[model samples]
Target: MLYWALVFFVVALIAGVMGFGGIASASAGVAQILFFLFLILFVVAVVMRLARGGAR
Candidate 1:
């Protein structure tokens, strides 16, 4: 998931450099959504582990 976010981010950067505004904006949006999803999942997992007393 994080890998995909990074991939889109890089693609967006390249597209922006090439002046493809539409494609860059779309890719950036995807990257942003994926990053936030990944972060939310990570936080949920950590909270679950802590609740189970599995902290390390």
Candidate 2:
């Protein structure tokens, strides 16, 4: 998930550099949304792990 967000971010940057305004904006939006979703999921996973005593 985080990987995808990074991919989209890179794509957005490239598109912006290439002057693809619409594509850049859309990719940036997707990247932002995916990043937040990934963050939320990561936090939840960490909390769950801690709740489970941090066992491997």
Candidate 3:
């Protein structure tokens, strides 16, 4: 999931550099959504682990 976000971010950068406004914007949006989703999932997993008394 994070890898995909990074891929889209890189794609956005390249598209922006090439003056592809539409493609850049779309890719950036996708990257942002993916990044946030990944963050939320990570937090949820951590919380779940702690609730389970992690490492004990």
Candidate 4:
């Protein structure tokens, strides 16, 4: 998930550099959404892990 976000971000940068405004904006939005989703899932997983008992 995070990897995809980074991929989209790189795509957005490339598109922006190439002057494809629409594609750049769309890719940026997707990257933003994926990054947030990744963060949310990571936090949830960490919390769940701690709740189960931290690394022995």
lDDT of each: 0.99, 0.97, 0.98, 0.98
Deviation from native of the Cα of residue 36 in model 4, angstroms: 0.3
Q: What lDDT tens digits, residue by residue, belong to model 1 across residues 1-56?
A: 99999999999999999999999999999999999999999999999999999987
Model 2 scores worst on lDDT over the 10 consecutive residues at 47-56
Count steric clashes of candidate 2.
Answer: 0
Q: Candidate 3's C-alpha lDDT?
A: 0.98
Q: Which stretches of candidate 4 lie over 4 Å from their true place?
A: none
Model 4: C-alpha RMSD to truth? 0.8
Q: 1-56, model 2: which lDDT tens digit per residue?
A: 99999999999999999999999999999999999999999999999999999967
lDDT of 3 at 16: 99
In candidate 2, position 22 carries an lDDT of: 97
Model 1 global lDDT (CA atoms, 0 to 1): 0.99
Task: Compose the digit string of candidate 4's lDDT tens values, residues 1-56.
Answer: 99999999999999999999999999999999999999999999999999999857
RMSD of each: 0.5, 1.4, 0.9, 0.8
Question: By lDDT, highest first, what's the ranking?
Answer: 1, 3, 4, 2
Instruction: Please report how far candidate 2 places residue 34 from its true position, in Å.
Output: 0.7
lDDT of 3 by residue, 1-56 (tens): 99999999999999999999999999999999999999999999999999999957
Q: Model 2: which residue pairs collide? A: none
